[model samples]
Target: MKKVCLLLLSVLVFPLVSSAQENTEPIVLLISLDGFRYDYVARFQPENLSRFIATGVAAKSMMPSFPSKTFPNHYTIATGMKPEHHGLVDNSFYDPEKDQTYGIGKKELVQDGTWYGGTPLWVLAEQNNIKAASYFFVGSEADVQGIRPSYYYAYDGGVSNLTRVTEVFKWLELPQAERPRMITLYFSDMDDVGHRYGPNNEEQLSAALERLDRELGALFEGLKSIDMTINVIVVSDHGMADIPVDNFLNLNELTRNIPGRVVNNGALAHVYLENEKDKKKVIKALEKSAMPIHVTDVDHKENYQDLMYKDRIGDILIIPDRGYYLAWGSALPRIRQNAESLGTEVLGEHGFSPAYKDMHAIFYANGPAFKTGLEIETFQNIHVYPLICKILGLPIPEDIDGKLEVLEPILK
Candidate 1:
């Protein structure tokens, strides 16, 4: 009886002890340079980020999730789930069941927590008595899992990158008990420039690289001044590809014979039908269309490499060839208007299949825990969340799609 009682008690006690251990003490800093392609370090020679790569354990490239766009991949990095698993299936998408729309450009929709399904890192951190902070991450300001970080700054694009770096340093300067253990910083200049001027435009890309290098230089010095000893992990959501001015394939014109709409995100477009009955007509129209683009019906599952949620996409998915994008209807979203404009002539875009080299992202980590001067080959971005948890000494949550063992090779 005594042995049985002790065994029963152990079952109850062990879980609480384990749960408490999730509040780790180690500090971690995550920095995201949006649209910083894997090759940018070698191609543009950004001195500061390159120096971090040389001394740190870095990966050759990080393959982004399908629909390799900004919001999906960034949310994937935070939640450790593919966009399908996280319910952020696209940069902007409508849920058939929920009849709800989600997009990064919509501030009110972004703040609403109902759209987010998976538990993000910051929310998980707070559950374990750990204080976390974020400068301007996608889910930072949201009431995700009904919890925000101990410190968060509302996203303001007008704010300078230098200020974002200084803000992280300021957070670190707080009293140990009052400070956050995990923090995220972001910069979008690289993504902005890469899109405004085609990635192939070496002259403009060179100027953007100089600006990125200066920020990295400043961030490192600020951390040094604050005496914050922690792991610094840098990554880009996805890379960019060149989409020339003349490459616009107007889906409306080609599919004019069919009755449907194309919800486009510059690089990828999803077709929706006025009625389910029109699916056949839409597919037939696309099949015979003259546009040089890839088309797949969600019902015909065999052809797709990774279309996690078929219902989320339209009846006929339109994937424009490289150097091209889809345009539809009378008016387009303002975000894509400049890219489609003649005078703007913005050339770089990325929503290509993840298999394409142009969609690969950057990953680098430097800290006491990582092996120095180490370079790992290409890996999926999903594995990133587990590595961040390992650096913080926190347990990877059970529901996360990532595996801690996947990153064990580089850990000391």
Candidate 2:
């Protein structure tokens, strides 16, 4: 009888132990809705997003790093470092040391790991023996720190959003050991529509928002079938502002006499001088223009908060007012063509100073780890990295700019 009782106890206790072990590890799903503004929830009221806000913690806005463009801010969120520190100073920048230019369209340079700095979250996970997967996120394609996510796909905008959601579900369905503990997903629906139709176009913007929200609803519903505890975080790289076609400033025409190579990214431009002595001449010429703009030298540490890669920032920075866009003469024809195609003179853009509320992005999180119905104040996007590290029980690298204390209260 004693032997039979011991056997029964072992059978029952073994299953309990297995179950506990299977569910003990936490899972985090980080999602990015490109160009999602902070006030989008109140403005559009997408059904799924509204539900997400009510069920989890949210911020009035999430501040992006300077030059609030896609690549820099996305990588900043990943590595918890500013754009200057990460080496991706802008969407397109020239590295004097490498003597090469890095741009979004340049696949060769983008895939090279040497162009990036700071340890990405995926790298941290892989280094610590935790598995990570990314459907599409900046720096996921390039092997930062000589390591990429265990599972990832090269970015292809043609892939359907629903298909991406399906892939995430398949990742989660893997055997416990093979499943990734941290996963990142990206959607450009809002950004795409915003750029083409402008953010103020409610008809087009609302349609995009509704469709993306439905996909989020599907993702949330699919997680219900899984037994493990998972947390979902939704964030955006930056927001959008409308720019009138008449407001487009032709840099080539304005600064033809100025001696420098100007690389313009919509609302901001980096002026690289052929001679260091021309810095004053370039700034004076740029300032002489009657257009509403701010010209500052890269040496002004206050502008960028101590950039690690100052040379890449160029000798001077040119920023336009919120409703104005600075573009090269060569690109003006294309800009006009695009506006004509859309039948509107106004187009949406970002990459301006974050001081403008219009440049702020969104942050929303839901799952077992967050406190429900809690709304927090605006905070920097850099803090997101450490918060994610905390959720996965991973160690935060000392060099990162993010601090855990800022977001720790939201966690249970």
Cα lDDT of model 2 by residue, 1-412, tens digit: 3343234334433343345334758899999999998888899998888998898999999999988899999999999998989889999988888887789989888888999999998899999898999999998989777899999998999998777877777776677888898899999999999899788999999988887887777677556546679899999999999889889988777778868777755778888888998888778878888888888887764756677888888788888877898888888889999999889989999998899898999999999999999999999999999999999989988988889999999998
Candidate 1 deviant stretches above 4 angstroms: 1-24, 255-261, 302-310, 329-346
* Candidate 1 lDDT, 11-86, residue by residue in tens: 4333333333232357888888899888888888777777887888889899999888988898899999888778
lDDT (CA) for every model shown? Answer: 0.77, 0.86
Worst 10 residues of 1 by lDDT: 15-24
TM-score of each: 0.87, 0.93
Model 1: lDDT equals 0.77
lDDT of 1 at 124: 79
List candidate 2 segments past 4 Å from native.
Answer: 1-22, 303-305
Top model number, TM-score: 2
